[model samples]
Target: MAQQRDPRGSRALKELGDRGLYWFDNTLARGAAALVGWLALLCLAVVVPVSTVLVWTDPAVPASAPARLAAVWRLTGETLRLGGKTGPPLRMTMSVLLALVALLYVSLLVGLITTAITDRLTELRRGRSTVLERGHVVVLGWSEQIHTVVAELVAANADRRAVVVVLADRDKTAMEEALATRVGPLGRTRLICRSGPTTDPALLSLTNPATAGAVLVLPHDEPGADAEVVRTLLALRTLLAHREGGREARPCVVAAIRDDRFRLAATLAAGPDGVVLESDTVSARMVVQAAGRPGLSHVHRELLDFAGDEFHVVAEPALAGRTFGEVLLAYATSSVVGLVRGGTPLLAPPPDTAVRADDRILVISRDDDAVRLEDCADAVEVAAMAAGRVVPERAERVLMLGWNRRAPLMIGHLRRSTLPGSAVDVVAAGAVGIDRSDLADGPRSGLLVTVHEGDATRPEALHRLDVGSYDSVIVLGRDPAPGDPAGEPDNDTLVTLLLLRQWEESAGRALPVVAELADDRNRVLAPTGPHADVIAHGKTIGLIMTQICRNRHLTPVFDELLRADGNAVRLRPAADYVRLDQETSFATVVAAARRRGQCAIGYRDHAAVHRGLGHGLRVNPPKTERRTWSALDEVVVIGA
Candidate 1:
């Protein structure tokens, strides 16, 4: 008996193991094959014109010429003729042959160009994609935020080659225009763009997530940004649930969902690997902190931006068995403020904490600090030198000029800080849907949660909110209710900002203002005078999303940065450190930061500030300008 052979079992079992990878391999192979085949075909076609000219122009033997002519005679070389005399048969034949050859050549040229452009156009029409490469980040969205995220990623990845890919609904040209205008000036960064809404199932495949190290999903302008995030979560889950074998899916996906409700939904839909960034929550928190502390935003700028103490997880192998406090006192030239075990991070936990082998140390210093730790120091002395070890004496009264769902969260965080004992008010036309009862008690045993209802766009209404009473005013643009028209919230936010500036002008006072803006286009209208701060909320969210997607473990690092007392975002004058006498080097910037007892990371050139582009400030200029940083320029940081 011929032992019956089982058929169709090999591929079936293999397919069950890793269907996506198999498909990805096949697709790539097929595309490569098709591309090569097309090139070969085009190369072959080139011979047609050359052969035609040779057969007609070269007086080959009469017999050979006629034979070749006969072979090519099937098609007539004719078109709408201009008034002219017809040449002799041989001359006419040669003319016709030349015309046919020229037409073929032209058609080939157009076809090649048209196809290349059309292929790009097709990708641009859809908005999400993943680069199939390790240690490379996949940013899924298109907007002004892309500029900042790309710039920072370039700086963070300066030590290592990094690739940042963008996926958005805009055409390739649109994405290219955004990159050129907003992010191209940043350091050496490789960018790839694809088209497709990140929420779509079919479109997501274009990102090639299986091999990506991280993925960043941006906050959308739609009222339902959260809902869309949920959809994206579902899509990601579907892709992940197929149970692919062999290759572990390590790509970390971080998406920004503006609403708390949607953020919860996204977590449920996606897993721990899927991070949902609540923009309102973070913005409000940052604004509140900055309001309480004059330069805290500057500190945050350094932490989050590539220009300063960017947060990173450094392995403290020597201190792995030691307590966090002991490590903090003994470790190198950075601060060990927090820990992340199995991807969950504790921001600024107690110092006398045990360190585990798997824990990722959250440190704040220059980029190199993450790569190496030099020594340990006294916790108290370190505290006085760094920041936040002691609370400040100043009491800040913060006024929120605009309202969004995140207002309450921001206010709550402010109360937790030194600002809780004082007044905190939220002024807005629409109702902020949040339960005030959930907030913590204050020095008076009850936190101050004041709501001043008014039209922020009206100068008089804005004046009524008493912007001058507070040290800083956080202006949050209204969020679109799920499914509202696009750009409406941005327009409203812009109008409200204009009204506030008008009030400031009328009153002749400039109070500190940290505003959450919906559109990057309105940056030109942004107030840049002292105490005026405009934040592209979406762009900020996008940068954070891009980073967490790039390095999932860094979330804890950012959490610590935003949590610390001396925590402030800063952009130091670029010229302070880099000496023109020194040879070109970004390391010089780092050295100067160390001297100032601060961390120098990256630089923001003059162009960004020229037009009040705000968040458009590109960090990490290429090594070309590494030799020296100018005073007109600034390095971002988070310190006193």
Candidate 2:
């Protein structure tokens, strides 16, 4: 009796309702056919009742039940767009069949359109579409240097409507977002990202490298990055060979490899037009150079980046037969550094060498605009020019704060450049591995080597070394452990810098320090005195690679400029080139340097060194700009 009561019956009906809903949901999940059937039944169940109510409620409807039922059937059929015939059954069946066929046709057309659009959009999202731009810059891979390269390229093309196409094995949207964040606004240049393995010939051709003005192959920041770069270069060569114009269609190629062993292989793969640089060697050389000269990196920053004065190659047909010494004073605004003859850069060549008819002179200028070729010879003040005096070399001392695989290379470079009796004290946690016999074995017996076992990151270790006695200090980041894939060596480097800064403060004087950083972004976090320089290895290489891509003739120019044994850019006392404490024009300085067999390009004001204005470094200043020469000012010149 209790089970038959209202409460019991209501509970039983609720359970049945829940079970029915569950079954319906399961059927809907089965497939689209089941879903369509359920949808049709649901429309019928609702529309038929509503149609029946309307027919019954209307006063003009027939009193007969069959007539009313017929009216409801017509109403429901019309509402559902099936059919609305009222006379013969066969005619009604034909109308319904025609309506069903028409509905099916519309549905099929809509589905086809949607499917086609979706497929096209998917293809675009996958970044497989071929770029149609001509004379564009094509970047073949992604790396830590991508941001710096792209930013510099954009700055270089600021006056023109240019495009940079990046082809890498990364998501297109992600690459775009990352660059937008890191590289900031690209101004007039447009950046296009494509996703694919850069080593695949088919995918590489999608970038349209044949029509590109230049192609830059960036190495990945990993153990086998050089290998990947080599393979990509090979694939690129293969693709270009099969293209319409074959090798003639290939653009100028520039690539960088981290390991020296892979440089020759990469160079061979890149062919005759490609320029390959060993990044580690270049960076080690730069660090050594910076350690020797405190403000040299700032000068290089001005030279390498596009935002400042940079190397430009221009032709001067009228001055072809003039001696390079006469050509030096040809332009008042631009500074001539070398001449490119037969595609070779002769930097700081003998002043008496005649400029060939086919030669193009390399100048450091603010832009690639046309040169007016005004003579600045009249502006030269011979009275203010100082007589040249040869400075004698002296033995020095150096302190190295850390160690890595590149340490040996740095030591070797220092040995080549340092004077005899110079000593290098290396303070780190491991044995320096460099032997005294190695230094003695060299042709020039320079750089007495000493290694102390201590953690450079520890303050006690830094304090024991007296921290500031050496002429200059070099801080290198700890090398990544072997086989440790996710190691971050910059953390240790930062700690060492922090402690070094503290020690420098305690010593009560400035230290000419040069620190090596792995990541460019961490350069801001480095702690040092006003005289310190932080060299990000990847950024230095990237800037040089971009510069090479812009002009292939600059390969030998940089080779001669950065190495220790050749003519290099140097900062000497202004008194050596001009009369100090007196107002003089840059032409007088240029004339003074010419007398000493050097090229005067710019100057640095020591008074403005720590004022946050590029360390007071100026490159390629106009010859007409006259200023009072202070005793502390330095003349930037290129010489042996």
Candidate 3:
């Protein structure tokens, strides 16, 4: 304060310093060449003076200023690698010129080498390099389903070495990390990720789709995902056509579209041989099916996933003339469900149907390696076989909580599957864009639908609806908003499940609940009783896609299995197939089911459920294995 020295002067100096810094930064930003030139000049200015002082300070140095200056030049030249030779002016000039020329050549070579290395590294980091593989699986696009698809592929290939190449419009490292977290160990499968737009044919070629055995076009979980899937399929088709060069054979393409409107477009783009699945329709069908049967979702999950017994088509030339009923008990470890004849799958064919030499028997077994034929017909107990017949279908009431895009389809399927007297009470917070006129005039007229505006997650709303009065409950999750995070849709479903569980606990009776979740991980968080079923829409679609990729013929099989009118999987009373409280081998159960025109694959034991033994379910058990049949036990069978 005492020195109130020129405040304006200080401000001017500060501004001048800032301008100098700005100039220096701008100069350096010009180019690498300019930066190097400045670096060289600055280095020379400091090195020369330091070298001169050292030379003059040395006790043995020449006293003349000219000699000292020459010594300094020699020292500076050597330090800067510009020729340190001390000689006559002409010789010094030649040495410096040669040194400069040599420096220039070395700098140019080093720059070329460095630039080449950098470019190659950048290409690698950017995931632009092409994958060189044969018979590998090429996956186009990325979504939540990618994890399930890749994991199933890995498990399906655990017996042999295989490769799975993924090309998506995402960072390679990020994709790798996400997959690593979702899909644990990859086993014998090798995964390669490339980053680029899947709609670009040039980028699609990075995965070598032509050489791939199968290509999966995954649709993202967002608006217009079906459109994007259609585009990717078109690009892939173009790439494959270019690579085929007039060849008729093409790689198997499996794709899915969320909306039915784009299903035809995706199918056309995928070619006649390709498979296009309507994911929304399938999900809706599964939810309705699960609502009718509590443990049906688990059975479907077991059949779709690769961890347990799955469908396998094997040739049994030795038993070509054998009847379908005899073939049912042919394999002690495998359960024969149907056969593939003339490139078509016939599930639960007539018992009298003869197995042709060209036909492949479709059986559910732990693995293809376990589909060995053994005589188990002798294990059957004729006395334990039930003489019961199929019962008549009855109408029931179903309660639907929450709503989404799949609700209308679910209602449609429900209406078709249920009898005319069946009623469905749909309780949602709002109408959710439903057209009331369409439901009353169309095929949906068979089933009476009542809309109630109430939040299903609230306990008061559920209590008011007389939650325990309904025969079955279907929990449909709401769709996410425009900028919602992944799995956020499942929150409402989980809360409703908890409330339902609380109601069950207070009432001292288990409620039959089937929930549709957006994320598979959220399934674990759901509070479920033995009768509750949680179906993850993404997992179901992913499993179906991977199944088609493994064997394209199974598309029809899945289509029929998910349909209510077709030979669908059902959980019937064990007493329907076997005598209650009687000890009999599973082969006896299988034989009894065969007589009833059904295929018994497994059984759910109510006693085992109380004991927590594999949730009281066993699929593809040995035919020779015997167990006591209780009325509480239900037989898992595929029937019409």
Mind sharing the TM-score for model 1?
Answer: 0.60
* Candidate scoring better on TM-score of 1 and 3: 3
Instruction: Please give the RMSD to the true structure for each candidate, in Å.
Output: 19.3, 3.7, 3.0
Task: Encode model 2's per-residue lDDT on 472-567: one tens digit a residue.
Answer: 889998766544442277887889878877777877777888999888888888887777888988888889988988988788888888897677
**Model 3, poorest ten-residue lDDT window?**
437-446
Candidate 3 wrong stretches, greater than 4 Å: 1-38, 49-65, 87-101, 387-392, 441-445
* Clash counts for the predictions, in order: 40, 0, 0
Tens digit per residue, CA lDDT, model 1, 89-174: 67666665676577669879999999999887664454443356656677776544667777778777777667777777778667
lDDT of 1: 0.61
Instruction: Please provide TM-scores, in order, for all candidate models, with all chains considered together.
Output: 0.60, 0.90, 0.92
The alpha-carbon deviation from the true structure for residue 268 of candidate 3, after best TM-score superposition, in angstroms, is 2.3
Per-residue accuracy of model 3 over 53-151 as CA lDDT, tens digit each: 899898888899888888999899999998988778898889989999999999899999999999999888878999999999998888878999999
Instruction: Give residue 618's lDDT in candidate 1 (0 to 100).
Output: 41
Q: List the residue pairs that clash in candidate 3.
A: none
lDDT of each: 0.61, 0.86, 0.89
